[model samples]
Target: MTKADLIESVYLKTGFSKKESAEIVELVFDLIKTTLEKGEKIKIAGFGNFVVKEKDSRRGRNPQTGDEIEISSRRILTFKPSQVLKGAINDSNA
Candidate 1:
């Protein structure tokens, strides 16, 4: 869902003011971002783990031109679902 949707849900569930809910959500997101920026992982017991992974430089082909190109390495954010979450999804699909 969108941020506004989340804020509204939080406000309704916690009886918090819209302003407070928004700020709380923003703070949580900022904390996650800052922690990931520092190359650390964030794990929620029943949800998943957020991690930053590194990609090595590699050669790639340009789709349009079919020419060889060098691709620079970069850091990417990744999420690994927890076993509980995976099981929930599988059960729902089944």
Candidate 2:
């Protein structure tokens, strides 16, 4: 869902004003962004883990021109869902 949708959901659940809901949603997202920017991990029980990993530079081929190129290493964010979340999703699909 989009940010607006999330804000709406929070407002409905918390009985907060629209402005307050938006602020709450924005605050949560800002916290996540800042934590990730610091190369830290966030773990939410029964939800998932957010981690930042570093990768080494490597050689890669240019798919369009078939030219060899160097790829610079960078930090990447990854998410691993909790077992409980996985089970819930799988159960719903089944």
Candidate 3:
């Protein structure tokens, strides 16, 4: 869901004003972004973990042209869901 949808959910669940809900959601997102920017990880009790991983520059080949290219180094964010979350998702699908 989009940010607005999340804000709406917060509003409905918490009985918060729309403006207040938006502010709360924005603040939570900003905190997550700032933490990730520092290359740290976040772990929620039953949700999952958010990790930042770094990759070094590497050599790659072009698919069609058969030419070698250098892949740039970068940092990536990844999420690993907790077992509880995985079970919930599987149960819902079933």
Candidate 4:
């Protein structure tokens, strides 16, 4: 589902207007992004962990021209779902 869908769900569950729901969802996303930008991790109970991982520069090959290239170092955000979330996803009722 998209962000709009998520905002709608929040609106339905909390009896908030569409605009307020969108703001709430946006605020949550902004908080997550800001936290990740600070090189920190967020762990939500029964949901998952959001981690920022760092990778060193590396050599990579171009698939088309077969030329070697230098891949720049970067930080990546990753998520690992909690066991409960995984179970919920695999549940038949879902």
The residue ranges of model 2 lying beyond 4 angstroms of the native Cα positions read none
What is candidate 3's CA lDDT for residue 51?
99
Mind sharing the TM-score for model 1? Answer: 0.94
Relative to the true structure, candidate 1 has a C-alpha RMSD (angstroms) of 1.0
Q: Write the per-residue lDDT of candidate 1 for residues 1-94, one digit (tens) a residue.
A: 9999999999999999999999999999999999999999999999999999999999999999999999999999999999999999999998
Backbone clashes per model, in order? 0, 0, 0, 0
Cα displacement (Å) at residue 3, model 3: 0.8
Estimate candidate 4's alpha-carbon lDDT, on a 0 to 1 scale.
0.97
- Check candidate 4 and list the clashing pairs: none
TM-score of each: 0.94, 0.97, 0.95, 0.93
Candidates, ranked, TM-score:
2, 3, 1, 4
Which parts of model 1 have CA positions greater than 4 angstroms off?
none
- For residues 1-94, could you state the per-residue lDDT of candidate 2 as single tens digits? 9999999999999999999999999999999999999999999999999999999999999999999999999999999999999999999998
Whichever of 1 and 2 has more TM-score, that candidate is 2
Model 1 clash tally, residue pairs:
0
**Model 3 Cα lDDT, one tens digit per residue, 28-86:** 99999999999999999789999999999999999999999999999999999999999
How many pairs in model 3 have backbone atoms within 3 A of each other, for residues 3 or more apart or on separate chains, i.e. clashes? 0
- By TM-score, the best candidate is 2
lDDT of each: 0.98, 0.98, 0.98, 0.97
